[model samples]
Target: MPDGNRQIVLTSRPTGWVAPENFELREGTVPEPGSGDVLVRNIFMSLDPYMRGRMNEAKSYASSFEIGEVLQARVIGEVAASKNDGYAAGDIVFGMLGWEDYSLAKGAASLRHVDAELAPLPYYLGALGMPGMTAWIGLREIGQPKAGETLFVSAASGAVGQIAGQIGRIRGCRVVGSAGSDAKAAYVADELGFDAAFNYKTAESYLAALQERCPDGLDVYFDNVGGAMLDAALEVANPFARFVECGMISQYNLVEREGVQNLVYLTRKRIRMQGFIVSDHSDLLPEFMAEMAGWLESGEVKYRVDVADGLENAPATFIAMLKGENFGKQVVRIGPDS
Candidate 1:
């Protein structure tokens, strides 16, 4: 272990698009745990779209990331030292920890032990963790896709979107997805078993693409990218369709957010559209775990991850993810897992 700890800190808040100058890589002394804390050697840290919202000064569902402070994310780590009675050294756990070589999980509530024997440590940050749960919650609580229905998932190759599209398939729905590139679209359609998928960036028109992929119209729309694609989804949505608004990455970094010109479709088609935060449904974790575990164990679900090698690369990886450049769930590996 190194005598010093390396961390990524937010230097300045981004006004529009996030730039590399917005962050700094700094080294500090490795910290010791306090009375109720455990010191963790962070192995993998998640990079998510929601973190973009947290960078802003404006108040939102989650607290804003203060400039000059180490940015935080869902991390998979092993306890290196412990001052808490319930924890011991070498325990693999998952926590909302910092983007550093080591972090302090201040209390039991701040993290929970994960079964590394059951799955890979990184899986706790992706498939079996927050992203997986987010996909489940949005589908179960909002979209509620039915058998024979046409389900459309935007950003289908992403962390949550991939799971959402797979779950829709398990529910007997005909799943179609939209991705940024032909390779990503093919990954969803050929590898992930989506009924069909299209590269939205290359398509002549979003509506035309959807028409070719989803001929029956969308009975459920799992929206991760909102903008013109959303307007196109509204145009192609069937009456009484359910729209699950998970995240809007397309508009997240924009100075002037785009307006939905086709919101009138919500009333005209009696479409039920709702946005949700997965944290609000924390009580459903056990239920979601059971359901997802079955799917994962049975080979009914597949997950992909794009891992950047070091903690110093986190900021660049995050910016790339925001630009739809990541192949799947974006993660940063800071330390050896074992």
Candidate 2:
């Protein structure tokens, strides 16, 4: 156990774009665990697009992060001290813990043991974790892409989109993707095996790019970077297409969100557009973990991570991720694995 604990707190709410000033790091006493409680030494902290919404004061699907309070994230940690019958010291676990060196969890409800031998600990924060499940549940319940259908994914090289497009391939769908850069687009097409991909930032137009990539028209749209891309997807969507609404990273920092003017396509084409949060489908975790892990082990699925070392760099890493600077699943390596 460390003599002291270090933590990051939300200093203020952002009007639009989040900045490093919004977060502040502080030193504190290491938390003491009572009965049925566990003290975790956070090793890998996840920086996700969804966390941006929680920074606001306004109410939404998730609770807001109170000012001056330690920011919470899905963290992979080592159990340093435990008073719970379900857990013991030296166990590796996952939980919604603070962005700090040490986090206190309340028994199994707040933590779940993970096998480090099964996959790297960081995989729990990416492929075998929330991002992977987000891809699975969204496709299973909404996209429902059929074999031979054309499926498109925006932010194709991102944490969730990369997984989603590969899952589409497994289902025998012709997958297309759009990324922020030519390199990312190529990575998705060449490395990740997408049928086709384009750099959305360099595209002549979202609709034009989508049309060229999805010549047959889209049957399923796994939306991550929404806004203009969403409107374009509507224009190219085939009748009875399914649109799975994931995070909208492009619009998350906008003062006024862009409106979808092509919504008429939803009714005219009989398209089903639905939004989902990965946490809402906790019951599907076991199923998602088993399937994704097998795919990863078999080389059917591949993943990438953009790691920033040190806890102090978490704020900068998070800001970079939102700006589309990170290559893949962004994680902050806070401590040594041992």
Candidate 3:
């Protein structure tokens, strides 16, 4: 075991786009577990869009990250030491741990045991973790998709979007996706089984693209990139359509958010547009896990991971992810599982 822990801390908050200078990498002594706590050596750390909201000074569903404090993320790690009865040394676990070589779980509350045999360690951060849960809850609870309906997903090649689109397919819906690149669009349609996909960047207009692909109109719109896409979805939505607002990666870094001019369609079309936070539906986790685990085990669902090696690169990786530069679920491999 290393004598010191390497950590990434938020040195400053961002005004618009997050910069690498906003973060600082430092080394400190490995944290010791207190009573009822467990010490974990982080193997993988998840990079997500939600973390961007946390970096700001304003409060959201979760508290903002404090300046000079170590960043926090969903990490898959092995227990190095344990004072908690529920966890033992060598136990693989997943939790809201820090962006560091090691993390001290103050209590077992945020941590859950991970069966490494069920899936790879990194899958817990993507497919089997928060991203997957976000996809499941948004589609099942809010989207309320039905068979033969057309479903559209923005940022379709991404973590939550990929899973959300696949779930639409499993529900017997015709799933169309919009990605940033042609290759990403192809991956969404070809590899992930999306009915059709287009590159939003190359498309003349989102409205035109949606109209061409979803000729019958969209019954469910799983939105990850808000702004222009949301506007287009509004225009193309079928009457009584369900719009699940997951996140707005497009608007997250903008100094002034882009406004949707077509919201009038919501009233005219009787569309149900709702936003959700995954944490709010913890009760559905067991049901979600059962179904998701089965899909993962049976190979019904396919997931991709974009990994950045080393803790120091987390800030760069996170910045790239915010810009849609990452190809799939972005994660930082900070330490070896072994």
Evaluated at residue 275, the lDDT of candidate 1 is 98
Cα lDDT of model 3 by residue, 224-247, tens digit: 998989999999999999999999
Q: In what order do the candidates fall by lDDT, top score first?
A: 3, 2, 1
User: 1-338, model 2: which lDDT tens digit per residue?
Assistant: 67789899999999899998999999988988998899999999999998999998888998999999999999999999999988889999999998999999976566999999988888899989999899999999999989999999999898999999999999999999999999999999999999999998889999999898888999999999888999999999999999999978889999999897999999999999999888888988999999998999999999988889999999999999999999989999989998
lDDT of each: 0.92, 0.93, 0.93
Candidate 1 local accuracy as lDDT? 0.92
TM-score of each: 0.98, 0.98, 0.98
Tens-place lDDT per residue, model 1, 1-338, is 56899988999999999999999999887887788888999999999998999999999999999999999999999999998998899999899999999998877557898988777777788888899999999999999999999999999999999999999999999999999999999999999999999999999999999998888899999999989999999999999999999989899999999999999999999999999999999999999888887888889999998889988889989999999999988898998977
Summing lDDT over every window of 10 consecutive residues in candidate 1, give the lowest-scoring window.
104-113
Off by more than 4 A, model 2: none
